[model samples]
Target: MRNVRPWRLVAAWVIVILMATTVPFPSGLIETGPFPFDKVVHFGLYAVLGWTVHRAVRAGGGRRPLSILAAWAVGIAFGALDELHQHLVPGRDPSVADWAADAAGYTAAFLASSVLARKSSRKEQR
Candidate 1:
């Protein structure tokens, strides 16, 4: 395992925090659509979070399953907290659907990371 840069992990976490606090939509910036756009946004955001956490953990010398598990745990927990925070915002309300999307994103990322890690290990062994 390569050494994980602490700064990279810190930067990833900072991005997550900024994203959580930033308003979802500003007036007139973008009109709401009939489609479920917010769910897509939640999935994408949590996907990034999961990827970053996975990278951070792998850099710290964690094994494949452990790294993936940690990332998923962190991403899901953060998503829950983010939803809770939105409840306090005047224009926003928490939704379980959003959290489900977040979990799905994290799960997808974790599975992909695990597959890649296994492939890498196989190649290294050859």
Candidate 2:
């Protein structure tokens, strides 16, 4: 509430992107799981993006909800764009459904963070 540390926020942003882009599953780590971790990849990425936005807003000494929400929306857009970018790669092709999943994850992350922030605010007021 008092200080907005720029370095810390940017560091978080980098870490989020790095973790999201790196697939540790070796392309065949799971053979027979009912639910593939591929979907989880989308969820975790967007959630981190949402959390990054929230953190950046807090870091910049901004308190308005819209700022964070805007950041989250941008994050979702970036996720979609990134997928499209992947299509240009030799081995990657974009999937609309995956983008939808990314959007869902982004929204879910934003909603969860907003609720948690609101709850924390209430607690601080008490």
lDDT of 1: 0.69
Model 1, 1-126: lDDT tens digits are: 466574377476657655665566453233256657767877787776666666666667777566557666877887788878877665677779878988887677766766786799899999
Candidate with top lDDT is 1
lDDT of each: 0.69, 0.66
Model 1: worst 10 consecutive residues (lDDT sum): 23-32
lDDT of 2 by residue, 5-57 (tens): 65477567656654555433233443247765666776676666666666666
Per-residue error for 95 in candidate 2, Å, reads 1.4
Counted clashes in each candidate structure: 0, 0
